[model samples]
Target: MNEKAWENFIVKNQVSKDIPEDIVMSWKRSVRAGIRPDLKKAPQILNHQDIQHIASTNLLHRIFSQLSGEMEKYFNKYDISLSLADEEGRIIASFVEGQLKETLQEIRFYEGGHWNESKSGTNAIGTALAADKAIVIKGAQHFCENWHPFSCAGVPIRHPLNQKIAGILDLTSVNELFPDNALSLTAVFVQSMESLWHAELLQDTEKIRQEFKTYLKNIKEDDVLAVDSSGGIVDKFTKGSNQDIEHLIPLTLRNLKKGENKEEIPLENGTDVKGRIIPVKRNGRMVGGITHIRKERSLGAFRQEQNSDSPFSRLIGQNDNWKQVIESAKRVAARNMPVLVTGESGTGKELIAQAIHEASDRKNHTFLAVNCASLNHELAASELFGYAPGAFTGALKTGKKGWFEAADGGTLFLDEISEMPSSIQAMLLRVLQEKQVIRIGEHTPRSVNVRIIAASNRDLKEWIQAGKFRSDLYFRLNVGRLHLPSLHERKTDIPVLANHILKNIDNQFQIDACAMEVLQNYSWPGNVRELQNAIEYAVLYARDRVIKEHDLPGDLLNNENQRYSMGLHLVSNEKNRQSKETKISEEDQLLKTIEACRFNMTQASKELGISRSTLYRRLKKYELQV
Candidate 1:
């Protein structure tokens, strides 16, 4: 392709607006083949029949099933009604609308029906397969003139592991109904479907994985063993064992070098359900072993050591705003300035702090946490600054080093600092300014070196104004501010966190894929904490082996937006709450701003806009198209 043609191709691939022509051409020449084109995924041909077809595919079936929920707002986003077809035009899954069910049944778009090029006459699905490339059948561009009323865009969904053509992600929409968005929605859904497919493929590998998971799940507290390719025990979590390592693990990697996937075996205690050994095959050889140590049939909590791409890992969608928040946190963590993390209670301020500390220089030191709100009046003052003998009533006989002293060479995390009494706020400020603190009831000051990480879900600006929190203290903590994206704002992180949790806890401990889907669509009101609790509860209540939808927490299932709908509106989560709290009504809020700008549509729209169409569509797929 020439530069101009390549440029157009590049412009088409990007979900954004026009790009520099030269840059576009450069990208096209760099690579083209095997890259799934976006044109194939548009919703240009969405219809009752389409939804019915999509509802059938295992990929879409699982994807949309997880999306089965109650939420007036999210209903239109998934619409979970799209019909997909294989290259040969064999109808897959679908969510057939009631009104069109009769017509759809008569047409060749229902399950097991065929719509290939030979049958339908050279269209998106058939042509894409024949040409071995994505194609867009624009309004009136259909090879069959009868299809002129609808436009179709389709890209072939390739098998994840083999990278071969699997099926087509085709979006059929009415001509001219934001045709451009159709392209984007198709692509986004296709990507999500692809991600689901990859996860499904991982299930095939689970049989091998189950070997270790089962063995580990039933293993005694100390019992450990490593197994080789044929499921033979190789080693344990540790070397020292009264029992023989020789009898346990097979002699294989003994001659191999250290760090060569060597096993670390835990001592054996009888009652190990059965030690399961899974081989880590590399280049056709069983290079190492992964052994699971299970004490109970129940699933365990996610041990961060294994950060697999599990369903409970994280809730990350295709939203730019939340992505920016994550990016901003990393940048803020790179500096030493005190970071004020603001967000809803469950939005993970502590997780961000932990992430920041792990990325900073003082990482090697102990991370000391002293909740200013958790301490009582007597302990609050002494807990922050070490106390000397007789410093106060019931003080430690000798002097006890406070959090400041304990975190002297490290980070002193102050959670809910706004709750810190006014008396101690003064001392905290002094420490921030002088880098030292005086022990309670002691005249002498103790020299301390610590990076103070303070956080609060409350608005300090308001507290400072109300005289509840000190202004000077607020300024100290505000040096480096990091605002966390609320659950609704970064809804994408929901899936990311969910997957992280599941991979860490579920898949290895128990197979609860269906329950994971339920967790994915849940609106975590308490943010990460609520999600953690729900999963923890489900892990415990799970009977019949794996956690299913019935095993999920009652509160989560009954009320999707329980947290947001209920009161606790913290600073970050309350951005919307604040607007709702202050604004009299939706129309009043919009009209007032528009009228203030002398009814300037563009300016008024800019003042409050992700756009009307955007707010209406929650698919994330639709936003990408826009």
Candidate 2:
């Protein structure tokens, strides 16, 4: 069936004979579950501990170790991702390649994401689990609109002993179609894993039995039990047939599955007991666990200490380039020297400077920020350096301490340093070299111990070449340097930054997946500041506290729509002569724009009113190099 048929089924509950019976049933089940058609991503229902438990399972660890190389080959050959999810549909492991890894992560297809039908709607993984068989879900067959651009196949892996479903082996393709052998390949992998699991269980059960005997001799006055991988009791040692100890078995299994090695279990008799579980492993695969139970000690109550905030805690970024910048800042923060931070406006230069100050020895002292660009040309010296009594007109009779002296034994941040007057730059250089500030119209110089952090959006090297800034001052300030990446250059951080912004506004507010996609695709010209404003605007207009696509600013939507239109136009005008002439002019314009932006794709795309992808395509068509 096509999109229209799918729409009819969803809107009117009318199923066509052309649609597969399994898909129809899945659709009905999804509707009954109250799954929204526009759901953007799978819910993340598992935490780090839960994922660790699944990953450490004997059977899964073996499967992953054995098949990782083969999975990588398949991913390289087919450009698809291979994922393993537990019976509950929580993804435990995924094998993906390069940029596709980030793309899939955006849709919550990574480890710890829940893909059960109740959570993620109708898809290969969920539908295959529901049917207890292999299935392929193609575009339009998926119940959720956000999943309509991809195709997926899933095969349920069954436990060898019980023939019951244990997990799922899935292959997903973003090209809207998979090879005919995709499902067969998934089944083959599952069959191999099950076969390996059967052999390992038979061999490990005997090893566990041998290991359990040694543990029994060491325990005295305490109950010890040996449990199989599935928590089935294999043997027990106790002073008597203690019924209360059996009650502890359930609690022990629960804690083990949560990846906890030790836990306090309170008995029905109001007696507290402590249980310690030690795993019995053969060849890196867990065979069973040895549980030791003893009376709890009457120790004082203890609480974990809260961690103190780091100076970089306020900085939010996960991109590799951004992380490197932060790391460099951290290294320089311990040294006593002048630092120069350079980046585009709104790229958090001042934040970095502040972080450096907070991380340094002078953090407890004053931290003063002066905007050199805003300083008056005539009064710049007087503002930066103190003036003696009756030094000039309107001067205070008692004299005044300038910013340099006021910020002594602390850090002083100078923003837009390139905009400082030429004479003031000379004075700043003198202060840095002499470690003293000479007051205006004063013979004596006052010693001031201060660390300087300078920031500028313009290229100071270019300004120096233009005779607008002093080379000596630039060199002194550049003792330590950091350049922050723009928001567009670090799009991977958009989701994190947006979520942080939302939490700051209201804990209940959230952004829809579709809205997040829009935010990620937009070339943010104003960097983090622009993103903050956009999120604030979205929250104000959001419905039901969820920021959907319609709630975004009109400019954001218009830009996306314009890019979509241009993409279509490019496809349709592939052969027209008039379009060829237009293309020639467009190619020249793109080249000029790239040169003007210094080969930075983000800025070039923003200036040209096109998406980065569109710009890349145009560059390829014209055979132009960056």
Candidate 3:
């Protein structure tokens, strides 16, 4: 139904047959809650601290960590945004993709926003929580006019142990028509989340058991008990009766907070026992606790070790060739000689240059990168060298400092050096030789001490032979040369590189063996940059933060398949060549027989033991007109 029908129902208090019963009931409840039909957005009830507290909850953290990747996939594929709301309808987290972010943000559909029926109106998150089931609210089915343009499907997620409504999982879209399977998909998602919740509980229990075992090694206590987060007993070791330990369990659970707490409990046998209960935590959330009757010293504070690796450590690779290149770069960083970095496109030439600058004594100064290929031909000279005041038309009145002057006392990275104009190359060579710069329209040369690091993906020797690059300038920059190998040349480093990229994006993310195998087998034409891009793409589409072969980019898989098919084609071509050779030998035999028979078809066919029609067919096959 259209907005007109919705307005009719709101103004006349008449329910339309087109509206579902659940929606009609929600509309009545919304009116009774004193919700305004023109409410612009949901009320935000949580601040930064509140949101942080909600996010720190173990259950919420586990749910988001497990489902966010799949939610991202759905959003990317279907243009849908997913959200999780607490039992009270306060938005806890949201996974949004596509251009609907602005629209959703306009309505305050984000973390800390309250969307209960009383606060906002009839909507998926609110109404589903109210109904305690899965539901779909499409365009104009909402009680608020502001939400009428959106369609949403929501399912309530229940706690695995208690079976109480924990939160609502919602799928929202700005499309004109709601997805027919949106409700069912949401239901399935909730089911998966519920299963994950159960799995998390079991995992937490197992972790608590392990922690207790570690504690058991030190503790000389005769009575000990392990309890989960819910105060349920997991395991117990008792030398005496179990009744005294049972009485201490509740007292231990009562003071179960952070750190260790000692509790004194009086048993029914008129004996008092002293025990210490330590809470076990995972990801900053308490999972379970261990209680034992023992006297122990206070725990020592933990100190984290600082990383002492040099700046070059950022360049991640384990290949022997790559390590050799890095070692050479490190050695070159000690000297102030001109360095030239050469590599194929996307092979991280710029990264090596940056690493050199950061490792040098001039690291504290500015490190400027200029793409010679992107520099305008007309302005190339002016951009590299400072321009005098009123140097030319549209020149800055203040006399702009070029990259060389700007990067003085530091390092200047000239990328795509082969693409630089010949005139600029002459100027660059002069700067390198003279240790100074002469700005355009100025006679007095400026004495600058700037280190140069030039990089190119093309072979400078070829460019010099072609007369495209100046050989003198090449010699000046080639004092300390480092050539980076392509990704294909270092196949063994793919897994480590992929894992490092994944760790930077999300530490919880992991690459499956199949996905890593696909990456290792593929030829990385685009090199490291392409590998990073592929990892990021897989991270976005992966499920449960586990990247699989199917989650990799289509181009990577297609190229791998194409390479395999090309190998098969090569083998088939070899077979065809052998078959053609055999046919040529047979043709030679037929020709000799015909010659021996004096060009008689009947004689040739009879001697060859074949019919005249067969002889004619053989001749046609070999294109022998005679």
Candidate 4:
């Protein structure tokens, strides 16, 4: 053929009508691999044991054994040879007749010969496997000059279970003897093999699933679940009570490796369940897994780990605003009335909630916390009210108990109440009023005895007025309210809080006077959470155990405006002004301060010398940025 013209076409990267697209692409790949058109032969060959190893380890070899006779008889008329190659394109089996078999053997087209595109340039087996499609490489289309005398047709064989290419099926003959429909025939055979293999795999999976179910039945009256690697439940069995098996496990549970195991899994009901994971292996590789749930036992309590001295004591502050809020919380916390704690983000709403739970009569019971903003409307509803079996698509066959049931006789802290969807807000109102929760898809409402502490950074009153929240819900939630002060409103507490935060870190850190001043001066828009973050950042980067002004965030330095000064004087101005006109002017000044500080409640509270929650109330009263 014309090497010069092909090289020119490759150099110009032009497509030619004479060459098929697949062949043209293969030629480009071969050229890029530094292959020469005059190369005498393809490289690489395996010994007998290596070929036997590949055949023994894969299902493709078994399938090939059944196909060999039919393939040999059909290609005998054309004087062609049929070959089967493993995923790596090494010939593991072949069927040939007479002189054509002899011709193929001379060219190392026998068992143990490798034919990958990288080594063999371009041949039917290699290129077909590489592209994962059936194709024919005729005469000069083959890259190696030695292969130019033959026409080869091949198709990739894929395993039906995992959809991975298991091998390649090929038909090769001298150019004159190549059949007209060789490529199509090979593809049809591979498809049939894959279908048959899939049927066998399904049978095996069913048998194994039945074995697992029987094992669970013999061991205990519990559930056995099998999940594929993709987190889809392949099979499940529920014994004794005959209730459907429930998969109340996270998708992350599917990531358990072959040997890695989880001994204890905590359920929403504050009970710990013992389980063992059995990894399913095929050919020494993890394909899926089965989980056998043994039994459920109540633990002391199941709460998220907290970085606090004691629940109430950790709600630290020496200021009057802090003192008043704490006193009010302690009084009503024992009363078992529903409470709503308001504050800016990171201003310790969760801390107060935890403290209330600890100080209340139900201190020893579970304290469950849920972030309303983190979940969607439907999910929030289903999570808080539980879901009956078949409530929605992909729902667990067995029903699930919601947070209300799980936190019975304890406390349920719903954070970010302002972000709760309108539909969920209405449901919550009913739950609070009736003291019962109706699970999705269930007509009956179950009674729940749980104290709720709803928290929000946003003003729910404004949300109600805006038609984004229900006023009735607001009224029900407003009974026992405590608004936490922002760090800016209580600047005097910063030094103490800073020390407490630093002590938690293992390393000793000394704050330079300038850095301390920077911490105090900057308006903490993110409130206490931002302060903790800054301290962590400084502690991480502190050189010689000292935090300097330069070590602080650059935003803190540039944040100095009239508003920053206002934060320092907020308390004094409030104390000095008692007249109605003065109050109106002060309200405008507070508005200006908040706007100047980018409407961050914590920052505005600090400038106004008020609590973050108080600032939220004011924002609601004026309907400004509500």
TM-score of each: 0.41, 0.44, 0.44, 0.42
Of 2 and 4, which scores higher on lDDT?
Answer: 2
Q: What is candidate 4's lDDT per residue for 1-626, written digit by digit as tens?
A: 44444555546866567777888888888878887666665554888777644554455676676666456455572387778888888888886757877777666888887788877788999898878888888887787777878899988887675667778989888998788998888787888789877776775576557545534433435566786544557777666342555444342254354254455645566675665565554432244567666544332221111112234666768988888998898887888899989988889999888888877877756688999889866587788889997899877655677989878767899998888888888888898989999999999989888898999888777887889888888888888989988888998889778877876663378887657766776779898899888888888778999987667776765664444435544544332343344344545766666666676766556656544544665668767763
Ordered from best to worst TM-score, the candidate numbers read: 2, 3, 4, 1
Q: Which prediction has more favorable TM-score, 1 or 3?
A: 3
TM-score of 1: 0.41
Q: Assess the local accuracy of residue 481 in candidate 4 as a C-alpha lDDT between 0 and 100.
A: 89
Off by over 4 Å in 3: 1-308, 566-626
Clash count per candidate = 80, 0, 0, 1
Candidate 3: Cα lDDT at 419: 99
**123-157: candidate 1 lDDT, tens digit per residue:** 56766665566666654334333454456677777
Clashing pairs in 4: 567-607
Q: Name model 4 segments beyond 4 Å from true.
A: 1-310, 560-626
Q: What's the residue-level lDDT of 470 in candidate 2?
A: 92
lDDT of 3 by residue, 1-626 (tens): 77877988889887677888999999989999999999999999988778755565548655765676566455462467888898999998877745687778899998889999889999999999888888989889999999988999999999888788888998898756457889988888889889988988898889888877655544443577899877778787776435456666665676675344545544457775665566766544577787766433332310000012246766888899999999999999999999999999999888888889878987656588999999999999999998987899998654667888767778899999999999889999999999889888899999887999999999899999999999999999999999999999999999999997887788799987657767876899899999999999999999998998889999977765555433322322121222234234556666666776678876665555444555676789879867
